[model samples]
Target: MRSSVPGTAKKFPLHPGHPERICWGCDKYCPASDMACGNGSSRTQHPAEIFGDDWFEPDPGADDAGAGREG
Candidate 1:
């Protein structure tokens, strides 16, 4: 199970190939186009949404596409 200190938060990127704009931030997988748990706010988005596609690049050897953060 995923564990973290309370009050702390983490962000996950949207899966690149999802047909619908789905949120990868948590296990919920809420769709960006029709967010059910967003409470009017768009579900957590990837840096690429605010920045550009190049905002985060995939690591050459890493298996997961959104494995790292730029800090």
Candidate 2:
């Protein structure tokens, strides 16, 4: 089951066209330069930035083809 944590349960886009403009640290989705949460850190990088464009895609070498499928 997915966690009920604040940011953890929020919906996030898989491939935002512009990931650099917003901070992903919190649900506020603050502007990169203006982090409202003040976590004492720079903007959190979107998954795409750290893992390339296919970050959410299933690994081709994985054996579990139905791992993330709903049905």
Question: Model-by-model lDDT, in order?
Answer: 0.58, 0.84
Collision count of model 2? 0
Lowest lDDT 10-residue stretch of candidate 2: 1-10
Most accurate candidate by TM-score? 2
TM-score of each: 0.35, 0.69
Candidate 1 per-residue lDDT over residues 1-71, each given as its tens digit: 23376555543543355423766455566777766665546566655666666666765777766568665
lDDT of 2 at 24: 84
Q: Please give the lDDT score for candidate 1.
A: 0.58
Residue pairs with backbone overlap in model 1: none
How many backbone clashes are present in model 1? Answer: 0
lDDT, candidate 1, at 30: 71
Candidate 2 stretches greater than 4 Å from native: 1-8, 64-71
Q: Candidate 1: lDDT of 25?
A: 54
